[model samples]
Target: MGASSNEAEEINDWELPNGEENKKIEEPQETTEVCARMDALGKLSSLIRNWEQNDVLTAVAVVGAVTTMAMAYSCF
Candidate 1:
């Protein structure tokens, strides 16, 4: 004989429970903080934080972006 309907339903319940099918599973806040720290380790937030404390570095960044874009467009 072929598989019955209840067996198929049981298989789906084994994969995901009844009420949680439509709900999104979320991690706790402590896990979120740990993941954020791990993800940001190699980023340049330290430099950005220093630029926030100093105005000269921000101005240099803006000027560098404009000069680089100008040189790039000139070559095309």
Candidate 2:
């Protein structure tokens, strides 16, 4: 069904009263920045993925042991 006049007017108000031209200009730049971010994140993730699970677990255990030892020594 066709929009009633009030509904049509409300829809028009929901559309940008201004800045449509600016958004059209910025869209490509926004997309490019997002893609660059995604690429960097993928590279970072791959670096982390290169670490073996055993290595990560051992590192975590070492840190935890160090923290526990420090806390115990501080109790003196």
Candidate 3:
């Protein structure tokens, strides 16, 4: 289910009208800034996930310790 050779040739031969091609292209600095922002967002998301996991684990440990202490005291 792909385009025929003649159709592909026709598509490849297409061109933008007048001076529109120059307007469509992005500046290199803008592209780099976008990429850097994406990377920073990715890193921030990862850090938050890890911090949440650590907090959950810490809570579980505290609960377990409290339960153990209560059981020990009840044995008196």
Query: What's the lDDT for candidate 2?
Result: 0.83
User: Where does candidate 1 stray beyond 4 Å?
Assistant: 1-53
Report model 1's TM-score to 2 decimal places. 0.30
Question: For model 3, how does the per-residue alpha-carbon lDDT over 4-58 read when each residue is reduced to its tens digit?
Answer: 9999987776667763333355665668889999999999898777777779799
Any idea how many clashes model 3 has?
0
What TM-score do all the candidates reach, one by one? 0.30, 0.44, 0.33
Off by over 4 Å in 3: 1-51
lDDT order, best first, reads 2, 3, 1
Instruction: Show how many residue pairs clash in every candidate, following the order shown.
Output: 0, 0, 0
Q: Report how far off residue 12 is in candidate 3 (Å).
A: 65
Residue-level error in angstroms, candidate 1, position 70? 0.1
lDDT against the true structure, each candidate: 0.75, 0.83, 0.82
Q: Candidate 3: worst 10 consecutive residues by lDDT?
A: 19-28
**Candidate 1 global lDDT:** 0.75
Per-residue lDDT for 7-73 in model 2, tens only?
Answer: 9877665646674522334443468889999999999999889999998999999999999999999
Best by TM-score: 2
Pairwise TM-score winner, candidates 1 and 2: 2
